[model samples]
Target: MRIGELSRQTGTSTRSLRYYEQRGLITAHRDHNGYRRYDHDVIHVVKNLRRLLGAGLSIDDIHQFGTCVRALDLDATPCASALEVYEQRLRTLDTKIDTLNHLRANLAEHTKDLRQRLRAK
Candidate 1:
């Protein structure tokens, strides 16, 4: 199908599809008229890409394991690189949570001290 059809079918913008092509996430062939043409199976690939993006995976992270995902066989066999990406993202989130918790505790203590000072005055 053409780019417009793919975009409509995937509910993705043509610009995003172009960006995906530039990022090596998707491939398209140029017709004689210079229109971008994609295979019908690319719809599945785009859906998977959207799912990964919604999960907070960056383009680079997706690219790392996109080949396995684009294979469309993940339902039967999960990719090892995909597992690694998930693990990395989880660790990053854990670190951010820890930092935020520490900040919250510090802020609570400061607020408590300021309240006591105000009461004394």
Candidate 2:
């Protein structure tokens, strides 16, 4: 299919698809007219890439992970440095969760206070 069709089917924008292609996350073929042609597997690859990006992984990390993904070997112990990177990501997620929970608690308290004030008024 063409880029437009892939974008429409995947609910993704053509620009993003193009970016993915530029980033080497996706590939496309050229027809006689030089229009880019994408394979059906591109859709699944794009979805997986989106998932990894959503997980807060950087493009470099995604590329590295993609290698492992293709190898189908998850058991190989990574280097100490890689483990440190994973640990840092874990810590960042923990901090983000804590911040979000604090924000939720504050919002709940403010809502309760506002309701009480309205009732008193």
Q: How well is each residue in 1-121 modelled by candidate 2, as lDDT tens digits?
A: 9999999887888998999889888899999999999988777677766665777877776665554432223345344544554677889889999999999999999999999999999
lDDT agreement with native, every candidate: 0.90, 0.76
Which candidate leads in lDDT?
1
Cα lDDT of model 1 by residue, 44-87, tens digit:
89988888898999998998894786866566667999999999
Misplaced by over 4 Å in model 1 are none
Give candidate 1's whole-model lDDT: 0.90
* Cα-based lDDT at residue 24, candidate 1: 85
For model 1, name the residue pairs that clash: none
Q: Which stretches of model 2 miss by more than 4 angstroms?
A: 67-88, 92-121
**Going through the candidates in order, what is the number of backbone clashes in each?**
0, 0
